[model samples]
Target: MSEFLIVLLAGVASGALNAIGGGGTFVALPALVALGVPPVTANAVSRVALVPGSVASAWVYRREIKQVEGVATRDLTVVGVLGGSVGAGLLLALPASSFDAAVPWLIAFATVALACGPRLSRTLASSRGRAAVLSPRVLLAGQFLLGVYGGYFGGAVGILMMALWSVGTGLDAATGNPMRTAQVTAVYLSATVLFLTASNALSVPGHLTALLTGAVAGGFAGAHLGRRMPARLLQGVVLTTATAMTVLYFLRG
Candidate 1:
């Protein structure tokens, strides 16, 4: 019962965080570790748990997704899928130590990206004009790389996606929300496939059942809230949470 509660609580917290800003792993990963799951196993388990949340959020954003430029959306999704598969393959081949050492730096970079994303988007939009800057080819390529990153680590996948979209797609931050959600959905789906098929995700502890359930429920609720909430406040929460998690990770490292 206690173990179940732990997973449930972690899931809800992670779901809310993921829906609002994208660093839910900060909570889920640590909770898994504290629950005595091995680091590698915890990473895989967290990804499994997160997939449902991302999917739920994507569904909630379906209406907004329809408004995206059709060509750009299709192209980016394709690129993201291809890139994610390659990234996942790389993850399976690389040494775990290599990624562990780099996680802190990546987190720090993601934090900065989220923090300044809005300002950067505004500047880019004004300089190149929104449509001109957001070329389909560039957006596709960038999202592809982000997909790989999401499959491999996925800690700040949402932030990275938003930043790339802001610069490469030139979408207004609020307008880009659905794109970000969609990108994350693609990455998570691709990663989950690679992880499961490769047998790399076999270590998920039974205790995580409750966590998965809560995440699914919370994700549904959070996504609904996200669509109705004020955009500014949502962005602010995401930035703040990401910044705090980045600092925490760096300090721990």
Candidate 2:
């Protein structure tokens, strides 16, 4: 019962965090790993479990979704799917030991990305004279890289996306957020297809089910709360959680 509760709560937090910002994997992945799931499998399972929540959040933002000035929505979706599939394939192809060794570093990188993303974006925008818009080729290329990172580690990818747009196009985080959610959904949905088919992520059906259920509920609630909540407050909470988790993982190692 305690284990079930832990997984369920992690899912709730993960879903909420994803909706508010993007740090769900920092919670869900570690919780699953602590319960004895292998690192690679935990990653695959986390992506699978979070899909519903991501889709839910995306739906809430559907009407607000926008393309970058010169980039088409269809092109972004297609590149995202292809990049995510390739990343998922890479995860399955790599040795488990490699993933295990890389987990701490990955988490640390994500934490840094989350913490500095806003500032970095602002700096980039200022350096670009504050009115610069990215070329279509640049946006597409960046999104494809981000999609690979999202599928490979499944953490803070949305934050990274917003950062890219903020830097490249001077888009406010609030305005770009819905589009970020949609792209995240696309990346995770594509990755889920590979994980469900090729990975052993389904081995722990009970845990997965609990997480999926909680995530769906949390996603629904978060979408509503996000409108009224201060994004900085939510982002701070997630950053602290991610930082602590990253430290703990390093200490454990």
Candidate 3:
């Protein structure tokens, strides 16, 4: 019962966080680790669990999907997907400790980016004077790298995507929003496929039955509520959760 409650609460927290932003794994991963799952396994399980939530959030944001225009969207999504697959493959091949040391730094960078993202976007937009001039090869390579990072350990991947889009692609923050969502969706889809195919999902203390139940229920609720949420409020929730999770995870590490 204790384990069940823990997983359920974790699922609820992760779902809510995901609905608002994109750091759901930051919550779920630590909870799974505390529950006695190995870090790699915990990561894999968390990734699997996150799929439903991302799908749900994507559905809720479907209306905005059409808002993303220009040729860059298709190109970026492909780059993200390819990058995500490679990252997931790397995670499955690498030792857990290899990533452990890097996680904290990544989280810190992401947190800082989330906090200053809006200001940075405005400043960058002003400087660009219309379209952000990006080297196609460089942007694609960067997106691929980011996708890999997202597949392996996805916390605040959205912030990274937004930053990249604002600086590299020269899009307004709001316009970049759906692109981030779409990119994340593709990355998660690829990661989930890789994780499942590799058959490396973590076996924790809690039962799959309970975990799935709680995660699905929470995901559904979050998706339903997210559509009606005010943009400012949603951004607030995302920033707060991302910052808190980064701090907590750094301490735990």
Candidate 4:
């Protein structure tokens, strides 16, 4: 019961944070692992469980979805789905030891990405009139790579996407957030399908259920709250959570 409560709280935080910015996995993944789920399996389960939450967040932003100037929404989603599939395949095919060895680094990378994304976005947003430096093809390729990373671990994927767009096209991260939520849903949706079919994510249904239930409520609420909530406040919360988790994971490793 205590474990269930922990997972539930984690899920609520995860879903809310994802809706607000993109660091939910930093909350959910560690909770699962701490509860005795293997790192890789925990990742798979988190991906599988968070799909609905992301979908809910996406639904809230549906009408507000904006397009990247150079990359078509459909095209970006296609690459994300494809890239996610490839990454999922790699996760399932690789041995657990490899994932174990990689988990700390993955978390660290995500923490760094989360820490820097907004700054990068702000820096580039200031110079917005410069012609987009990346062509559509290049942007699509970058999205694909990010999808791979998202599928494999999915910590700060939404922020990373915004960062990529900011770097390549000078899009303001805040301006691109609604679309980022939508793209994150696509990436998670694709990974969820793969994890459900090919991974042992369902081995522990109780924890997953708790997480899912909390996430659904949190996702819905967060989407609504996001309109009123300050972005910097949420980012600070997520950054702190991610930073602490990164340190803990490194120490444990």
Top candidate by TM-score: 1
lDDT of each: 0.73, 0.79, 0.70, 0.80
lDDT of 2 by residue, 1-253 (tens): 8988999999998888888777788789989999999878889989999999988988887887877656788998888888898878888887656555666676677667666655675676577765455677898898898788788876667776766676566565566667878889899999999999989999999899989988887777776676566666656655676677668768978
Measured against the true structure, the TM-scores of the candidates, in listed sequence, are 0.89, 0.84, 0.84, 0.85
lDDT of 1 by residue, 1-253 (tens): 7877888889988887777667888888889889888777677778878878878878888888743342456777777778777777776777556776777787777667666655776787687666545666666666777787777777888877776655554444466667677777787777778777784466664646766777778778887887877877877776787778778877887
| Candidate 3 Cα outliers beyond 4 Å, as residue runs | 66-71, 133-138, 168-179, 202-206
Which residue pairs show backbone clashes in model 2? none
The residue ranges of model 1 lying beyond 4 angstroms of the native Cα positions read 66-71, 124-134
Inter-residue clash pairs, candidate 3? none
1-253, model 4: which lDDT tens digit per residue? 9999999998898888888877788789889988899888898988888888988988997887889977889999999998888778887887656655665676566566566754654566566644666689999999998898788777777777876776677665456768888999999988888899888999999989999988877887888777565666655654566567668768877
Comparing candidate 1 with candidate 4, which one achieves the higher TM-score? Answer: 1
Query: Candidate 2: where is the Cα deviation over 4 Å?
Result: 96-130, 231-253
* Cα lDDT of model 3 by residue, 1-253, tens digit: 8988888788877766665566777778878878788778888888788777667667666677643323466887888888889888888888767676787777677666656755675677577774444566777877888999988787777767665554554454444554566678789889989887784574443544455556656666776675566766666665676677678767877
Better of 2 and 4 by lDDT: 4
